[model samples]
Target: MRKQMIDSVSKVIAENENTSLFLVDIGVWGFRDVLKNYSERAINCGIFEDGMISIAAGMSLSGITPFIYGISPFILGRAYDQLKLDFCYQKLAGNFITTGAAYDFSKLGYSHYCPEDIELARTMPGLEFIAAGTPKEFEILFNSTWNDGNPTYYRLSNYCNKFDAKVAFGKAAVIKKGSKGVVIAVSTMLDSVIEACGDEDVTILYYTTLVPFDGITLRENLVNEKILLCEPHFEGALLPAIIDSVKDCAVKIKCVGVPRKINRNYGTKIEKDICFGLIDKDIRLEIRKFFNN
Candidate 1:
């Protein structure tokens, strides 16, 4: 997936003279060779995450398409003030390419963990927050949003494409059809949701983009009103929006995800999944609870 994103972005930068890439000590090994191979186009901004956002914003204002790249926590979480003030405040467009979704690199400890990153991003305006669960979806997101006029976030998760489905960023895709209820899986949680619902009769909606969530697709899913939100991030990240979407309709909804409190849990992401009730059994339990109610 990283190769796909890098290759696509590199090709774009090579072709477009006005576009530039800003790197901040992340994915150096993955992209250093390819980007440095571009020479003048890629700027190794070092450890200054906030500074990079400002630089990207300034460049964007100057008619140069600047893309900020690096670790998820630093690029988005650390440089949030700059993001809010520079790009979002000015309503300028800059590409934010982030690696490591949530706990993709859990060995770095909880400080690097970012289940709440979207919670912070959700407060900002005019930013498109996207979590790509599959390689094809990642490629589509890059292709669709590369030079768009909105501040876009491309969160690269550890999970790849598990099943074949049409690729659309903000719009939800119904991978499986059912009549009992609907299971809305966010980002890479698609696999877990699939396994959990194998024995049950439920429709699975795979949503990639967080902001600018496709309301039209959502309305289509309203036929099966009961929704069980399955996400890898903190619970309630999408609850507010989900509630707002179905305000005029009668719908039963429940969100199953990590808690708002920081995860002091240890070991790998899967272990953390067990710690936070994101395992398949827990999700199945939640599904039963939501439908049986």
Candidate 2:
């Protein structure tokens, strides 16, 4: 998925003569490779995440659409002030491409894990948030954001599995059209939701865009069905938004996501799996409970 994102961004740069792609990288594992491959467009700022964000903001102010790439924890967590003040507050045309959403860096330990980036970014006004489940969906969202000229944050996982790119901006896609219930899984966890549904009467709503959420569609499809909102990050922005949006509906809404606890153990992929309840069996159990309740 990382390679695809880089390749897609490169294609966009090559094809769009007016737009220049500037990549800001921290000292993450694959930073050098991205820098080496896209030398002319990519910039290595060492470990200064906050500085990198500010630089991107400046570049955006100068009429260049900048795409800042970094680990989730550092890009969003470490550079919170810069992101809020420089990008969100100033309303720059910059795109934050966050890799390893949720527990993608589970093996790397807790400092490397970022489980609440979505919630954090959603709090800031004027910043658009998107979580893509597949390469195709990401392509659509990435290109659309550039055309839309919005301050956007895109969360991507390291690996790519084939998924339907039939997703629409500001709305969720129904992966499986079922009537038993609806499981609205945020980007990285869409596949798990599909598997957990099994033969049950469950519909999977892959929510790619969060900020300008598809309130019209949510109101249409989530009327009387049992609703479960799943995300890899901690429950905050999206969860509250879902609840508030559908508060008047007769649906039973439940949120499934990472527990709001600072992890003590060295963060690994396994730890992330545990944090988001991504284990197949565990997810299945949760789904069963949601239906039972």
Candidate 3:
């Protein structure tokens, strides 16, 4: 997925001579070669995440479509002030390409873990938050934000899978159709929900875009079925939005994601999933419980 994102972005840069890609923390694993191969002007801002965002904002002010690449936590959490003040507040046209969403960086410990950035980004005016669950969706997001002439923040997960891009920019894609209930999975975690409920009597909605949610489609599909929202991040805005959107219906709603507990110690992604009761078995059990209720 990282290679695909780099290739797509590089292709865009190659086609457009006016655009430049600036990477933050290119010294990190999996990105060193991308930094070296791309002919476009790229910069390694060392470990100073906040300074990199500031510089990117300045570049945007000078009429450059700067792509600021970095880890999710560093890009969203470390440089939040710059993101809020310089980019979102100033309304600059910069694309924040953040890798490692949710537990994607669980192996790196709590310091690098980012589980609330999307929800945090929702509060920042003029900042768009996009999460891609599949390679095809990533392609659409890359193209949309890169060419849209607006400020955006994009989050990518290390886990890659094949999915239909029919509902790329809309509210969510209905992966499975059923009359009993509706399971809404957020981006990367959509595959898990499908695996948990194989051949079951339920509908699955894959939400690739967080902001600018498609309310009409969401309302049309969520009627008369129990709603379950599964995500990798902390359940703050996304879950509530689902409930609020379908408030007029007689549907029951629940959210599955990181628990409301601070991390005392960090472990692998699988370990974190187990700790938060988000594994396949647990997910299946939760679905069963939701229906049984």
Candidate 4:
């Protein structure tokens, strides 16, 4: 996990001398001591989320590329205006490396939680969203989207666990083949989805990139037009993307994710998962009903 960030950030900065890295007060979790390796271009903006985003925008406008790192909620929710104008409006390029994705920080309460980040980021036009669920996905997508002219958000989780899953940028990977139905698992939720489907004859699709999603492949691979879409995000994060993919078909899609209600529930990630109906049994029930009915 550390190697992915260190190596990828080092390479991006090395290749682009005009780029800089910014951090909020929460750098310890995401960057660690490795950020000092790029001290020359580091901007530790303390806890001023909006200020840091505006400054990064200013820097980008002056022909400099800025890579901002911080918690997901603050980065996307707080500085949304600057993100919309400075980067999106000006058509400038910048990168956001965010942690505490979904409920990864649920124990920290709603202030630290980011269950709606994907839904919020989806509102911004032309922003590419990548959820590098596993370490391997991090290496490939982070490197692929680094230092581009377009704006991108790289949502992350604290889990350093590695998976053998090879995720294409926009295309969905079919982990298993099934004639019964298909399951679309987004990023980190792939593990739980795998466990939930255990030994069941069902097709599973994995996605990293949310925007510009390969809905074409998603539609083509639908065996029964019955999709059990799983995500560790809010209600409509990937719902629209899937809808766009299977618009023409009579696809019956049932999503398994956090509820679309007040998320006042606070606890550890596992507790929050259970509170939000993200357990394996819930997923299995959803899948069973989707395929059976």
Cα-based TM-score, every candidate: 0.94, 0.87, 0.90, 0.92
- Cα lDDT tens digits, model 2, 163-227, are 66587778777677666677887877777777777887777777889887766666667634588
Please give the CA lDDT of all the candidate structures: 0.81, 0.74, 0.76, 0.80
Off by over 4 Å in 3: 27-40, 162-165
State in Å the error of residue 134, model 2: 1.4
Residue 32, candidate 4: Cα error in Å is 6.6
lDDT accuracy of residue 55 in candidate 3 = 81
Please give the ranking of all candidate structures by TM-score, highest first, separated by commas: 1, 4, 3, 2
> Model 1: clashing residue pairs?
none
Output the worst ten-in-a-row residue range by lDDT, candidate 4.
26-35
What value of lDDT does candidate 4 attain over all alpha carbons? 0.80
Q: For model 3, what is the alpha-carbon lDDT of residue 122?
A: 75
Question: What tens digits encode model 4's per-residue C-alpha lDDT throughout 1-293?
Answer: 54576568767776777888887866554455446666777657689988888888888888888988888889899998888887888888899888888777776777877778878777888888988777778888887776668889988887532475877677677888888888988888888888889877789988888876888778778887788889888865788878888888897778888887667877688887887778778788777777876
Q: Residue pairs in steric clash, candidate 2?
A: 106-268, 106-269, 107-268, 107-269, 109-267, 110-267
**Range of the 10 consecutive residues with the lowest summed lDDT in candidate 1:** 158-167
Candidate 1 matches the true fold with a TM-score of 0.94
lDDT at 118 for candidate 1? 81
